[model samples]
Target: MARYILDHSTRPDPLLAELAAETAAATGESAEMQISADQGTFLTMVTQLVAPRVAVEVGTFTGYSSVCIARGLSGGTLHCFDVSEEWTSIARRYWHKAGLADRVTLTLGPAQDTLSAFDQPIDLAFLDADKPGYPAYYELLVGKLRPGGLLMVDNTLWTGHVADPDRHDASTVRMREFNDLVAEDPRVTVVILPLADGLTMIRKNPDLS
Candidate 1:
């Protein structure tokens, strides 16, 4: 079923496919951190739908997701925050190759620190960084997002461990807490889709305080 879903979904571009392959070959086991092709397609679709002028991504593994988001932007800019220069260097190559270098900016540092420097409104935000930092990132991103803007969070389900009380690992616990917080927040209407690990989409209410 998963294979069929992918087969029916939008096919990745040649550059995206090449980037995914290079990332898998280079990163070995860690390549799983990269978003799946279907998720990439979803990101691009949402980005195009929102047509955000300013977007932010918290995690950029090898640039696959970044490429999707940047490609969908209609002459907007994307600010990517990640702590690894090594991984982002690979992403930079693909961004350059895809002619998105001008539309995207990469910042190497703790996302919390770098994200603090931005006071401008954000039209869209994607969070796929450390699980423990989700709460902090959420607080920051939600405040920065303009009313009616979208915030997409990845890995909220944590491989279904979030619903398993027996699984009390740190990541699982953190995700569970974050999920509950988002669900209860009056600022946004939220829905969690069982895509990949789990993708939670939140749209800030127009009357958000």
Candidate 2:
């Protein structure tokens, strides 16, 4: 249903081609991880709009989205969570080259643990981690987000698997559940935009009770 709508409306941005090339070249190696350029642009646009002072990002895959978010943040702090040192090392070089290393902090560990340790209210949060953990991450992050804070979840469409009842993989199942959960929740307003695999945007309201 949603996939059909998005499929017809979807159009690729030109910026992604350049970023994809740069990200691939920077790694100098092929891997199973990489984000679409359209997604990267979405992150950057969101960051630029909110101009958050403190941001939390779960799943910094090769730092493409991280770099995009960080670039939009002038003097703000961006906390990135990832368990892979090898993957992040590749990200670091690009961060440094992009002159955004100083504003970004990489936490090497399970994202849940890293997120739990934070005591301050997050101005903005990005969740792109394991599909099964979306519920848990949402619980914790929503509690931590300040009023009007933004929460962005990537890969919500699961490559059009969520709507297909026949394709019930664990990841797809979890994503479907998460999507339904968010839609029903009254604490925030959500917009599931069909851009580069689908991004679910949630804006928290302080008065929701």
Candidate 3:
């Protein structure tokens, strides 16, 4: 099924393909942290649909996803937060190569600290950061999202461990809790798509008080 989906879905552009290859070669096992090609396409589609003037990405590892988001933006700005200079530095080169450097701003710091200082309303927010930080990031992102804005979260399934009764790891437990919290939240309508790990889409209610 996954192979069929990939085969049928749109492929990444040459630049993006190169970026993915470089990321894999550079990071080896850790390259698994990068978003899959299908997920990247999904992100671009969502960004194009939202046409956000301002989008925020909580995790910007190596910039593959950031490139997709930026490409979809119609003159919008993307704020990317990541703590590792070593990882994001690689992203910077690709951003430049993709001609997305102007649209993206990379912040090297704890996303928790940087996100707290964000005061402007956001049209779109993508959360691909630490599993344990999802709750806090969701709180901050939801509060900042304009009514009718979209929030997309990656890896909610945690490779299927989220539903497994025997797996009680900290990440799995936190992801389960986060999924429940979003499910019950009144501010947004949620849907969890089984794309790549698991992508959760939340749209803020337009009828805001």
Alpha-carbon lDDT, every model:
0.93, 0.82, 0.93
Q: Quote model 2's TM-score.
A: 0.85
Q: Write model 3 residue lDDT over 1-209, tens digit each, in one string.
A: 99999999999989989989999999999899999999999999989999999999999989999999999999899999899999899999998998889999988898888999988899999999877788998999999999999999999988999999999987888889999999999999999999999999999999845
Better of 2 and 3 by TM-score: 3
Q: Write the per-residue lDDT of candidate 2 for residues 1-209, one digit (tens) a residue.
A: 74564455433444444546765775666533466655666678789989999999998877778888997796799999988897788678778878898999999998788889988789999988877888999999999999999999988988999999899788788889999999998899999987767889999977855
Question: How does each model score on TM-score?
Answer: 0.96, 0.85, 0.97
Error of 1 at 139 (Å): 0.4
Clashing pairs in 2: none
Quote the lDDT for 131 in model 1.
Answer: 82
Question: What C-alpha lDDT does candidate 1 achieve relative to the native structure?
Answer: 0.93
- Encode model 1's per-residue lDDT on 43-126: one tens digit a residue: 999999999999999999889999999999998999999999899999999999999999999889999999999877999999
Q: How does residue 92 of candidate 1 score in lDDT?
A: 96
Candidate ranking under lDDT, highest first, comes to 1, 3, 2
Off by over 4 Å in 3: none
